[model samples]
Target: MPTPLAETLTQLRIGNQKFLIDFYQRSRHLFARWAQRKHQLPPDKAHGLLQDTLLDFYDHVADGRITRMPEDLRAYLYGMAQERIAAHVPAHQPLPAAEASRRQRLLAQFNQLSTDCQQVLTYFYFRGYHFEKMGGKMGFPNATVARRQKSVCLRKLYDLVRGGYEPITGEVV
Candidate 1:
């Protein structure tokens, strides 16, 4: 379903992913120059052209090259292809009404947590740090303490999210 030029752009992007990240320092310039020359257009125009060309390239070659590619290169090529596609396509804007409401409620519950709990949760969840690593950074001896603290914090978060509960009868109104 893709044009031939699109297929070639995909191949070039796929090939370029090899070698070190530092290696690309010079190659990026080369790519820019090549792109300019090939398209024979001004800067912005060339960029737009490059994006479209890359998309066409990716549409056909995606399955063919993906399995055989090296890990780093595969990641890089996939990223480039995806970016090219994304450039022309309008991005999805904002959460839906229900999602927005849910997110707001979740944020309010998170804000109600104690400062220490908030820090712990942010480091572990949002920052993607492991429990052991967070424990080391936070001065806990091991993961167990960090895990325990996370559990207590999560329980408090649950209570907040559930809204006001009965103190004695423990039933939702």
Candidate 2:
């Protein structure tokens, strides 16, 4: 856990592992005691659940989806831990072979996009930038144009993943 004592979800969203550790330390003991009362779980299992909760919280922040944070990280982490512990298995299990392969292919195709397309997608998907702002920065006439460009890039990527098709628009490269 971060020893600074001012760790916040903002820090975690910014890729600070210290904040994650801080959350773990702050909530683990309380969650462990609660688990003892409600479940016949081993210490290790409870610990694992706490870790998973922290990771899930981190993912939500990084995914541009966590708009608000709970007032108390301890209570929030404990609540999420309760759901995870009840599952009796890791919260997110490994993907099956087909799904994993498909993901790899999609990622490969996405990586092959033009740099501008990659930047737009990253800002929109990872940083949660709105289309208008992205369009302005990228010099598109309007958000609609930016959105259409994104759609075209995605379609190109999808086709490449679906089959060994020609490049976007069949241009000889």
Candidate that would win on lDDT: 2
TM-score of each: 0.44, 0.53
Winner by TM-score: 2
lDDT of 1 at 165: 37
Model 2 regions more than 4 Å off:
1-41, 51-75, 86-93, 125-130, 165-173
Over the stretch 72-155, how does candidate 2's per-residue lDDT look in tens digits?
A: 767777777777766765654545789557655665676566666666666566555688997897888999987887777666
Candidate 1's error at 123, in angstroms?
A: 1.5
Q: What TM-score does prediction 2 earn?
A: 0.53
Q: What is the C-alpha lDDT of each candidate?
A: 0.53, 0.66
- Poorly placed runs, candidate 1 (over 4 Å): 1-93, 165-173
